[model samples]
Target: MSEALEQVAKNKDDVAANEAALEDLFCVISSYNPDFERDLITRAYAYSKSHHKGTLRKSGEDFISHPLGTARICADLMLDSVTIAAALLHDVVEDTPSTIPEVKKLFGDEVAELVDGLTKLQKVSLKSEEEEQAENLRKMIVAMARDIRVILIKLADRTHNMRTICHLDKHKQIQKAKETLEIYAPLAHRLGIYSIKWELEDLAFAALHPRKYSELQQMVSQRRTDRESYVAMAALQLEKELNNVGIQVKIEGRAKHFYSIYTKMVRKGKEFNEIYDLTAMRVLVDTVKDCYGALGIIHSIWKPMPGRFKDYIAMPKFNMYRSLHTTVIGPQGKPLEIQIRTQKMHQTAEFGIAAHWLYKEKGSSAKSKEQAADKLAWLRQMMEWQSETDDPKEFMKTLRIDLFEEEVFVFTPKGEVISLASGSTPIDFAYAVHTDVGHHCVGAKVNNRIVPLHHTLHSGDFIEVLTSKSSHGPSRDWLNFVQTSRARNKIRQWFKKERRQDSEHIGREQLQEALRRKGLASQKIVASPEFSELTRSMGFLKTEDLYVSLGTGKTSAQQVVTRITRDMDSVPDLA
Candidate 1:
């Protein structure tokens, strides 16, 4: 190697070494907390460094740099000292010789417990790759339910991992990138951590769909100058207008991320130029009163598109994201998205639950705890349902379906608001209320108008479930229609124990009928060698279990038969 090239490489290594940035993190954490335990955190850093003595990442950088970056991310959230410490040591037990007992002795039970949670969530292969991911996600969610900090630290860890993903094999990069986009990004969004959510989506997008991401990146880059100029003009106009109204405002322009644009394109079937929010602006101001005032001034300045305004501040989202959004007709005959929020709201929107500590708490710890419990109730419920649901594939499907959905807000008869995934029926509403309510649910009145059990709920609808003591229980059809895991489980549980013979008989009958329709016989199909493989592939133990699953409404008979037929076709003369 040439000396000049070696010197340049040394400089690059110096740049890549992130220890100096970690020092900045130490200063930031200590700045907010003067008496912060600098020694304790530094001790964790020293221990992790010692344990990861001579490791390197696929990026050819020091392995310790990953955890250091993760720790910095945690510090950016202004998390508690213990959380930051755990972030520093998250990968130690997984990748190094460090043990949980050692972590406990060195860092105390709190840090050790968090680290154990991360360790116990190791990805285990079930029957297939899908099953492995589902089981892994289940464990992670269950752990997250126990302690919210687990997910926060995991997000930070994932953030650093994705940021340095370039060093990985192309296939692994695509795999991790897809996982980040499909799972972690939504998890972060569900937690209301926009700071993590937006970047994770973009990074994952870049890795998974490199050419498309590059195209979008270049498209946005090409418009950067014009967009910046428009935003500058708009900001001056809006700031001046708000100032005239005795409101102080800070304005900034935001370019929508590549993944967000790609999602819009795919979901809405829109082109890049058709995305109105690409060139957007944010107006941060003092006081909620000023926030609303700025909105009024913005509306006066430009005509707002009808129905484009969402008052998230008045009714915060399930993740506690608070801001007011609107779309206005802007200077170049283009639509502009404008978000108005107080400084506190902006902080909370960015950091999510972490902001609770960063900003001074408005309520007592007891109230904060109550709010946190409310926010994580859905997660706890999903994890609890995992044990009740027999099929891990079904459980994973339900988990993903329920996790990323937009919710509808409904009012109970007593006027208490309940939030549920959009498209959830009144049966889902009853189950969301309670298991007994769902089990006993016979009919419902949506908005005081009597409706069937399958009546789809909408935001602002008032629902009253009518139960009868004499009612037999949930119908099997509820499995086909009910949108919540809780409701589905309650119904599945009823049939699972109520009539095994009847369910088995029905299951057999259904499978026979399906086979007959396909011009095949049930016995011949079941006796085939591929039948057991088919059952196992479906996450069933035996043919009888598959029948029972079909009868009990845990799975589909037609779907299973269709799969069997496809498998049979793949091998000639199977029977």
Candidate 2:
């Protein structure tokens, strides 16, 4: 059969599948909305199909199937009609010649606006494929300024694509997988979509490096039968023990992700057999009190691993993920991590951002809704940052640093908890709390130990910042000492506005020093077309302006040097 014919057949199958999925999805919606907007959803799906009629994806599936899958995921989230409609038409403008006006005509202005918000700029070009990808990411962020739902829908589409990426070529598979790992996964994390983020990472890791993927998969699969049996027996025992104590709990087991396993192996230099807690049992109870009550029962039955306990219920992760993690040695002397949480935490863990819909559907308490809303604040902040920053490269850089970094939880003297990226110093924490705290920071106390402000905080560390009124505001050097982009950006903003002359002077000296180390002075190098073009390509209009921007901390020095070398390599030598 011809490729086009195969695609048409596949699309027919997809449409059928989507109908079933949509039917199930409508049931969920029916519980929430007495009069579900079924007509609008049908119209959106029909419009998507018509818009993408002749187009086939690299996987030889009809392009419309992608949008339908995205819409199904959105509907599963119980998102508003506008969001679901947007998901249906998200790729119409970007992948097809169908205009926003066409979408507006077919659906409505709200749907069209979302489609436009999700569309990528078609005309921008960059010198390298990597640069082009980065620029495309920036364009996406810019589009996010119009509406946050656009990016959310795009993320869902990417997740579904990654799941089915095996149909693409090896090269394309790796490319798409890498994009998912670097861009879409991080975007999902920032949006508090942990389930999507985890799956995206695991799938992308599997496709990009099949050898390691299969190795870990085999290792994980080998013990699955035994692991299931152990968990079942343990859960049964725990249930009876808890039931005798008048406590109710739901217990289940989950295997760790391949990427997560591989990461631990690489970091700890441990073989697969050395890694304990591969399969974990989770207990969900009715109330927070019950969560602790269940935890005590588990500990009474099994010996808990020393120093392997975490209470996120009191001080949750930045994403608002809450649970009590305790590694305990079970009946066989095998280490097993048991997670204790309330039913709310289980829903958040499984559905993440979609938990909002679940809560709304069930008429959950106001506290539950507020908890979900509080977690979404980060997403709003990300959208705001994208709006305030015009530099796409900067936005991408900040996002990469934030998304890929792990976090540590610390506490203030009054017992208020603060979360910072792992490797973050007190300076990062001070800045995270408030700019004034960072600016006036003189010293820090980690667990009451008088430490320098650069001390990296660990979990459960009680931090106290020592401030001096006579002390100067944050030094330019503090920027380098901080781990988070939030701290670094605030430092730069202060220097950019408050100490312009000093910043310019320091920036100039730094540039000259960097050039001197590179064996190319500004006088000799700035005159070269390679250098000038490199600066221009990096978004600076002039070579001196580039240096000044670097000095003022607006642009990164390393990026400037790397671009110069790359530009020089591309220039034809005339000996």
Candidate 3:
């Protein structure tokens, strides 16, 4: 065949392949939403394919493949039709000549808005790369705050990128891998999407440390036979016991992911062989009662290791994760980890908010959706700090702390479970309960015993915060021990408000001193038109803002004086 004819044939083949891919995706979507609009998906796929006609990815695949893969992921999560359509068109406005208004005209407002949010989130640059990354993170969080589906699409897009990341150069691979490990994985974990979180972590780990990844892979593979044999033996024994107890159960074993195993090694300073519970068995039952009954039966069969039990069903994690996790001695005296949960809880444990979103869409009430969304108070807290925090570094620091910290679940006097960062103090708990509760807190009672405000709380602790209206608000000392960003930020805000006047006074004095040194009358310059323009140019709305910035050490007095002199020099002097 002629060259042109051959090229045309290849294009037809690609089109057929793309259609097959979309057919598979449609099957997945129909399983969840039988009435989902096939026409919308078909239009989106064709629009994306045409827009990306000549574009190819680094992996030498059609650029259309990326969006198609992303949309499939969203479909697997049972996301709404609009999100799937947005996923199909997410890169169109950014990478192609298409614009948001064009997308809105083509699709509807919901898809256009999501595409716009993803577009804005993709563009971030500032003074340095670190600042740019921090800014990008802030943008993603803000976008999520507005519409949670934005991050959902972004995460789907990232998962596809990581899956095909090997096409990039070494430096690019490491950079993308680190970003995924640091930002995206944690976001997935925070959302309680373990399926995505685990995949992201393992993929990133492989990219960032290829040698260590190979080492761990070899180690796990080498032990597969023995592990499988042991798991089968344990499963059989457990099945017999549960059946005897009249509990219907399905037990399955899973190898711990490489990233999690590596984390355990580094955290415990142990070698691969030194670590136990390399495999975990999950028991899925029909009811919450069966979950407890299975846990009891498992414990009766094997002696549980000390302090290795976590009853998350009684108190779910901040991300709405619930399971009864325990490590016990098993056959051949090896440590065996097990989790017991109802089949419904198992779904939530794996799919997290996506499962809730699916529930909300299946004719569930609006109130049910709100209840699921209320669990994401962390997202709202990020928005609060983003508004208050001007420094990108500070915002990223708080974000890292919030994401990476292990959780500790404590209870209030009213039997409400409040989740705080591990090593959290009573002040953190107080703020978690209410800002007023934290400000008025004078002392605390952990399990009915008086304890210092700085005492580090443990799980299952019943805390009672003692407050008095006559007492002063939070102490500067609380800043030293508070763990949660909410507690720390609230304390700083209190101080900032209380000391604003003093800061203004000090800042004015510093400026006047600098003016005296420059042989300029302080009052004349302060009231000058030049000064008004300078303050506005310096990003202050009013003179008090300038003073506050100076007092807070955010603006140096010398910096202000230098700007003033420079502005004066630029202007023509009037006689």
Candidate 1 colliding pairs: none
Q: What C-alpha lDDT, on a 0 to 100 scale, does residue 190 get in candidate 2?
A: 64
Error of 2 at 214 (Å): 2.3
Q: What are the clash counts of all predictions, listed in order?
A: 0, 1, 0
Predictions in order: lDDT: 0.83, 0.76, 0.88
Model 3 misses residue 288 by how many Å?
A: 0.4
Cα displacement (Å) at residue 125, model 2: 2.8
Ranking by TM-score: 3, 1, 2
- TM-score per prediction, in order, is 0.82, 0.78, 0.88
Query: Model 2 — which ten-residue stretch has the worst lDDT?
Result: 359-368
Candidate No. with top TM-score: 3
179-213: candidate 1 lDDT, tens digit per residue:
99778998888888998999999999888888999
Candidate 2 lDDT for residue 43: 84
lDDT by residue (1-575, candidate 3, tens digit) is: 99999888987887788888999999999898888867877888889998998998997778998999999988877887878998999999889998999889988887899899999998565888878988898898888777777888899999999999999999999999999999999998988889899999999999999999999999999999888889999999999999998999998987799999999999999999998779788899999899899989988989999999999998888778889999999888889999999988888888777776672342443454466568788888888877777677777888899987889888989988888899999999999998999999999999999999999999889999999999778899898899998988888888878799889999999999987877777887888888888999999999999999999899999999888888864432222
RMSD of 2: 10.0
| Candidate 2 lDDT by residue in tens digits, 1-575 | 99999867876797787677667656765665656567887787777788787777776666777887787777666566667777887877887678988888877777787787777644368776756766776677566544556666877888888878998889889888988988888777765677788889999999988999998899889989999999998899999999999998888897788888898999999999998878699888999999889888889999999999989888776666789999999868888889999888876665565565442322342444365556665444455455455555776787788777778888889988777889999998887788788889998988879998777789889888888999878888887678887787777777666665666667767765666666665555656777777777778686667766877788776666666666676432222
